[model samples]
Target: MLELDGTTMCKPGPLNPSIRAHSSTLTNKRSRRIKGCGALWGEIDHAQGVPAMLLISIQTLLRGALMVGGVSVVLAFSPLPVAAQERMPMRIAVEGAFPPFNYLDANNKLQGFDIDIANALCETGKFECQFIIEKWDDMIPDLIAEKYDAIISSMSMSLERRQKVAFTEKYYNSPSVFIARKDSPITDVSPAALNGKKLGVTSSTAQESYANHFYPDMKKTVFRSSPELYKGLSDGRVDIILEDKLAIYDWIANTKAGTCCAFKGPDLVDVTFFGEGAGIAVRLDDKERLARLNEALKTIKEDGTYDMINAKYFPFSIQ
Candidate 1:
């Protein structure tokens, strides 16, 4: 006879002939189950018969552990998303010598139509802008070297310029005009009409290019700057001076040199010489910044800011 001291465990009783055979088979099955448990679950004791609830608990623990392990592995291998970066203040380059477009006042501080337009663009773009005065000759190279982010110095949009940098839509366009003393009798602008006349133009400007290309027969004198060109006209060094119509008009109304001159015949503008018009220039690689600038330009033009600026500088529309 066998007895369980504290637990209510089942016990085998005495058996007759048929019951003895069944008892032997049941004992054999119990031994096999115990052996299987020892092999797969060595920590579980099987001599007292395996507990059904214990097997359920083990399965639940194993499944939970596997789920946690899988989640940890995925988290270790996966990459997190990165945040967007903010842009720095943009540095804009302008030619201080170009008046009406840009120039220095009596205080030597930069002020002009170009400067106002630049400020408007920056304000509309929601970005801080700093204007730096640079020579027109070195503007493109300096931009490529990252010295400045853009040029708003009345730079004409040309195929030759597009090779090195990108340009926004034309901000302004004006026809080139010839200026002569009101007393001078230079009326016709035809090539044949000005055969013996001497023409004065700023060097490296569209006026000079036009003079050389179309009126090669006329005597041409090139000056380094606008003041020099006007000086040549006032001094009688040249019979007629070709330049931007609006700029000359401003000079005539404001400066003493312009007082002696008046428009000779007609306003001349050819895309080959003057290009599409003056535009803001940026480095070719900076497409994103250029896009922002273009957007800002459109915003200002549509918001009445552009018209206000035009009214401040001129009695007529220059847009």
Candidate 2:
């Protein structure tokens, strides 16, 4: 007989034939069973001549022991269920210079839409997530080097990036646009119209790719961060800047320093330049983690959590 929980006792013997037959029926319908302990315990209660309480106590004991490094002993009986295993904490990388999406506040703490969305995904997935500040250019290399498990910065899912990492379905989509001084003469925003004009773009971004691909003859000034890119336009270091339309709108409509600039021409979008939209990126090999993030993203969107976060950041939906 095996003693469990210092109270329940059951002999090691085959279950009664009738009980075994009944349990088999339950096992066959496992997929339709209601989730959680109650449904399982209720089914056990109906097994005739079997000590259901003893089995429950034993399961509880094994679970407690496994938590304290008894894996080998538990494996002797059966492998632990995937759901029973503790999940490793995830480290997420974010660029702390992009405002409204992600940025460092006055106290140097990370804040903004990206941070909030990352937190919501982690919460929904029951993951312990830690955010690491990384340079926009270094995010992918750092993730590949295992410095972080994922990059939650507003990274576009461009083809070049897809080759290096896997991206979850885009959390939000926004178009790219050009921004120039309100009084600037360059209105057409074409390569020919702006011949010899200096263009500002953040290095390693899709905007830079677009500028290089479309305006090879135009002079280009690359910046390392969004704030620097905007400053280049405001301080007259560059004649014009191209960036995400929503981000440009956030700066122009919300900040006093952005008073000098306004959108130029039409929204610029190309499947080759911006593959889809902003997505959370994980290492190419981390498929399990990527799937979890994608599921959590779907859950948050369905449960209205995503809408709350979106509304807090923007007046209209960016999805």
Candidate 3:
């Protein structure tokens, strides 16, 4: 039996038609053993042990195991050994460099939407959360390989991605916008106009698909990170870059990447190349975690917490 620590259990992935385990899934074998004949009770007090005991009880109940007044749960073959609830920390993967959404602050501490929301989710889910800065390129592969439990990077939920990994409810959304040299001889760049132009985009992303589908004749250069893509455009390696409008505004205001470049229309929306805005990424097998995330997301959105977080980073309403 493979022992899946919380870290190795849930990996990041895109929803796909052909589903792979992505990683070793914890069976929660439940260790169903014949109990004290029927109602063998262990420490079932929530205050004495860890809150996680509640989960064990819940799991046992869901498996057709009976609950004995919340004191001891009746198992099919259980005088359950009832291990003390362990509040172990959960491991998370993130692109620690994306700004506003999830980035390393001046203090070297991770700060961003994903970071904040991850923490909030941990609180709600009652699991310790640790974030690892994984590259965008490797997020899905490593996640499927069981590198981490979840990815809180600014990943969009789209049909293409859904084919590979499962996504939580959308948390943030921004439309796509074209970035070009401010003084370039272009008003509105049409797919035809880009026939021979060098266009830079994030490789293997919806952005690439958008360009390929819309402007097949246009030359496309794909970079791994936003900074790289921005640099490619600023250095004149590429004529234009299509990216999120919010990110574009941030780059233009914060760095010289936007100094000579301006966002050219037609504008980009969630449905464009980026698909839908940001959401949490998890393996397809994590039904519990995915279901939990959706529940928490619904609660946060209903309580206005999500909107508050969004307002702190983005002023304009993109919904």
Candidate 4:
């Protein structure tokens, strides 16, 4: 007759998914027998009487075995165990340099609409999140390399970018505008009106691509950063600036250099140049991660979280 922990081990009954077992105070005298029959037919050695920790592995292995009905199963499990997996935090990436969307405050802490949106998503999705800062140009490449998870930077969703990384639904769409000195007479956005004028745009962005494609005749001056472009504009180094309208709005309202510039003409939003809108980007192969972010984004928008963040940043809807 088969014996287990001094009890006759009969044919094992149907295994319960939630299996538990208890053991007496362990000693070096002999290996201990598990009370549960689900662990198949093995004696677990309780090292230094630490049944508390070994029992957990015993239960997990038993449970995992029960999943396959008495078959010895070899499986890799997370070091966190089942409960800890639920509390694991997600890693998110952001440029951390784009203000109004995402930037460091006076105290050098991350705070802005983009950060708020990321927090809201984490709340709605019931997951913890940690934001990481990456350079504007390396957002996509680093994402693919798995340096971080999702990107919440104010990255425009363009065809060229879509080819590299997957993007969630657009969070907001702001039109592009041309800004020049208030005294300047360039009122038209047409290439004919501003052909010979020097135009400044951020390097490697949709704005630069737009100017290069449409206004090829215009002297295109690419700056490495927004501040540099604005400096060029303020010092009369560039005759015009074309970029996101909301960014331009923030500049004009708060910065001294922006005071010298005003909107030149109507908003420009060609899909060919701008793609769709700004969106959160993720790794191309991470479909489930993408789905979770989309679900979180939808929940926030439906529950007014998005509106609250928007109002805190802009007076009008940028959506």
Identify the candidate with maximal lDDT: 2
Model 3 regions more than 4 Å off: 1-89, 270-273
lDDT of 4 by residue, 1-319 (tens): 3332222222212222232312212122221111221111232222233346776876767675444676766776544322222322455666555667876565445667777787666555544455555556667887787766678878889999999999999999988988899888878879998889999998778999999988999998888667677878888999999988886688888878789989888888887778788999988998867777787788778988789889988999988
Which candidate gets the maximum TM-score versus the true structure? 2
TM-score of 2: 0.74
Which prediction has more favorable lDDT, 1 or 3? 1
lDDT value, residue 302 of candidate 3: 79
Which ten-residue region of model 4 has the weakest summed lDDT?
31-40
RMSD of every prediction: 35.1, 18.1, 12.0, 18.8
Task: Show where candidate 1 strays beyond 4 Å.
Answer: 1-87
Identify the superior model by TM-score, candidate 2 or candidate 4. 2
What would the TM-score be for candidate 3 when compared with the true structure? 0.71
In candidate 4, which residue pairs get closer than 3 Å at backbone N, Cα or C atoms, i.e. clash?
Answer: none
Supply candidate 4's per-residue lDDT for 60. 68
Provide TM-scores for the models: 0.70, 0.74, 0.71, 0.72
Per-residue lDDT of 51-89 in model 2, one digit per residue for the tens?
569568667776743444644444235533333433335
